[model samples]
Target chain A: MVSLRTKGSFLKLYSWLPILILYISVLNEFDFNYLNLEYFSFNFPFILIFFFTLKDFKHFDYILVFIAGLFNDTVVGLPLGISSLSYILICTATAYLRNITIRPNPVKDWFYFLFIISLINSLNYTILTLFFSFDLILMSYLVNTFFTFSFYIIFVSLFKYYLKGLND
Target chain B: MASSRDDFIIAIRSAFLKKSTQQKFSLLTLVFFSLFIIILSSLDFKVIRYSKAVINELVYRSSFIVSVPENFIKDSFIQVKDYTNFFNKYKKNISELESLKSNYVSNEITEYENRELKELINDYVSSSNKILAKIIVDHDSPFLKSIIINKGSKDNIKIGTNIYDQSYLVGRVIELNYKTSRVLLLSDLNSNVPVTIAPQNIQAIVTGSGVDSGKIKYIKSGLSGQLIDDSIVYTSGTGAIFKSGVPIGKLKFFEENSTNEYKVEFYSDFSQLKYVFAEIITQTSILPTTQESNENSVEKNNPLDAKLKILEDELNIIEESNKKFQKENENLKSEINNLNYKVLNLNNKISSQNKTIDQFNLDTDELKFLRLNLTYGHKCRKSLFNNKGFIVGSAGYKDCVLRKGKIDG
Candidate 1:
């Protein structure tokens, strides 16, 4: 029942993409280790790519991106608000890419969003763990990564339906 | 369109000023987190784990529900611990029992002695007419100062039948059913017996304190002192309920006040009672009414006669002592009367002394008047008679004026 402007609608979904990712991943298992699973790295960047492929650089779009990433950090218990800022930068880059190039398939364009942001998340987790120096079992790291990716996939799939409705 | 954009920019700038949804959600989360921490700490899981005291289950609805899973989890863990402990204890008991069994030819000897003792008891009991039964351990009562015995109405262990231990009489069977009977300890609240102790031959009514110890109350209030240590209390058998010479308890201490009543601390350890037996003695013969009346009459008359004899002897003794008291009393009375007479004499002398003082005062007044009148006459003679040619007339007029002033004053 709620309507959004075409640009606003796309920006809103783009911003919530990371929240979707964190929800699916965190709910299944809340371990925030980055290098724990090799397979999870495959789907990780798809959500991040979704953010970077947005058409415009409206301040509101960047804000949504920031909020979504921050929410992901909260739900997944990642480093406090770092992801939100990284995600806003990712959104800016996607706007530039959209301005320069042809709009690609929704899946591939979105995969860039997933791939890049997850890479950033992984890097952040590694840096955080290095400082922490607590002994963690290898299985726990794998579980965290797998859950995070899986959580992202399910919420994004649901989010794609919202995106389709917005476009229509 | 320009105005809408300006408005939009204003809204965007002001967005940070508005409290964010994150702030509100974080507050809720903080509250929930605090609640979780309080619940965990307040439950005191460590105390519940280690404590031997019975655990209280229902602190609240959440705790009650929480405790179910917690108890189940703890139960399995504790079960293992208990099993290990039981195994260790079982091994220890087995070893000790084995060692005891190895050396103790005394056990066999005791068994043989027990059979022989039973034969001896049987022989004695046949002659004395008594029944002996082993104590059932499960029949003990934690709440009541009583116990149920194996023998009951079926065994003819009737009401008022005396129950005893290996060497001492314990109590009596008060309530009995067909197969089991409840015997009230002498320490029961409602239980009372008149006990006469050995050595001192002291008599006291021993009653239960509704606790483990029997109390001896109604000790002679006006009696100078209290129960001394190691005073053995025994059954007086006044109601014919207890056999005389049954050991009750030693006097621990007697607390007394102006009321003359005292509580006697008992030395009998009631808590560890292990073996007890009851003796069904025959019902005591109640005294006939005529005999009881005769005994009462004799008791009354005898006391009266003894008092009368004591009174007469006391009177006679008084008569002998009266000689001394009589002379002493008379002397005292006369001395009192003489003292009264002396007091009266002293009063009269005081009265006479007061009269003399009044006479002295009158003499002083007369002397003063004489001096005043002579001075006045001298002045009148000099001034009026010598200087004036009309001496008699001036002197008479001055004398008349002086007389008038004296009369007026």
Candidate 2:
């Protein structure tokens, strides 16, 4: 009986791992900057949120994603709600995509993610520069978008493995 | 076409309004909430500011807690890298240490002189205390370069407080919370510092290139040609935002598209900073306590108090210079007196030598007369039989005998 209870608790922990990872990524800023590569960075939270929300994972609540965005802004020392708005917009885009599609294709999803992140990053750049008067490098944003888009497929594959394990 | 348009409208409606079973708020509501927060944060409302500060305090603490594992891994990686290059780094550091030690004494004297001059110029004496702060979170974001430190308003850290890595200026505090603050590094794109390039003494502004170095901007057109590599860049303190003469970086030149571009390489590497010092400054005015009322009356009567103050400072400097000259004059007078005393002793010794030489000449003449008397006494000396001779002791007899016995004939 004790063994069965332990197994059930372990399964529950495993099921909640996606949200846990999301929180950890935002708080820890899980960009591998220790490599010391110039102009090398990717938004791990963006990839995580897009993949999980697109699949409509049961435990991946939109509210939690919103909170994670707040945490990200605080960690990155940006004005509050900038990242929260970005995260919510991503969820909205994914929700709209989920509604329109009868059969999901990874290639179409990938292209859609590219378009969504580009739009979102442009909006971020516009708001920060116009509203906050921030002097941000246009090249940094472009590079970040490119790398984030390119790394999506690799992260999607890893996330797929996690989801597959959860299904079992 | 009508069917596809209707489907699109239906999908859009669902995406905005629909909520999952586990979700509490619809996507549309969250979007509005985020927009409201953005507007509220920009407006500077008192309650909103307090709430934001509270959130920052909580979030920063939690982030520190969450970053520990990653920090450990990062520290381990850096430690391993450090070990790999230990010998080379040690060799370089030893050479640097030797040069730095030589500079240390002159630097201390200059610092003392600078302090005294500043005190003389400004009515208020500004004293600074640099408190140590640990960088709790250093997320090298692509857009913004900032670091969160474990010091804030509670530690007397205020907005615009200057931060340093050792003695080199690193950044300044922009946001302060209860126990944490954010430092906007000099490498951020938004950061601009008024600096003076040394040796040539060109005044210019340095703006960050969103990278490791800063770009020189707003300099005089022709003066750019005068800048050379390794020229020291230090704060000019023009706007009073930063302290004067704080070392910022060294000037570097790189060719971009066949055009010379100047950059500042900061002394402190922002990426490698683990601990920093946040300088807390306290200012005390030099108020006239003794004759306050009289000074106040004089200040009110004279519109030229500032000019009078300048003249008073000049007078004080002149008086100090006069005192130094007086002391030097006294020393020269004593030196002259000792020299005159030596000259008098030399004159006395010359007179004594002249007297001794006179006595020796008299004795030589006497000896010559005695020798002559022995040889020619029989021929010229006076006796009972010879009336032409005189006594030997007489002056004429001595002269006649010394003349080789020749008489008047």
Output the number of the lDDT-best candidate: 2
What is the per-residue lDDT of model 1 for residues B1-409, given as tens digits with 9 covering 90 to 100? 9997886555543332332433232222332343343244235465532221111111112222333443444446556766979978898999998997876787678757665554433322211225665433211111235554567676777788887765466778764455555567676555677876545566668777644466766555433254556677877767777765566777655545644333444544444454566675543322337854565565556756644554576689989899989999999999999999999999999999999999999999667655655555444443544453223346463553355323223
Tens-digit lDDT string for candidate 2 (B1-409)? 9999999999999999998898899999999999988888889878987888898889888888999999999889989999999999999999999999999999999999898778766767899999999998898698898999999999999999999999999989998888999999999998989999998999999988888889998999899999999999999988988888999999998999999988999999888899999999999976656766566666767646854675687889989999999999999999999999999999999999999999999999889877877898776778888788777777777677878887673
Chain B TM-score for all candidates, comma-separated? 0.35, 0.76
Q: Provide fnat values for all models in the order shown.
A: 0.00, 0.80
RMSD of 1: 35.1
Candidate 2 total steric clashes = 1
Model 2 chain A scores worst on lDDT over the 10 consecutive residues at A30-39
The model with the greatest DockQ is 2
Model 2: per-residue Cα lDDT at residue B368: 86
DockQ of all models, two decimals each:
0.01, 0.60
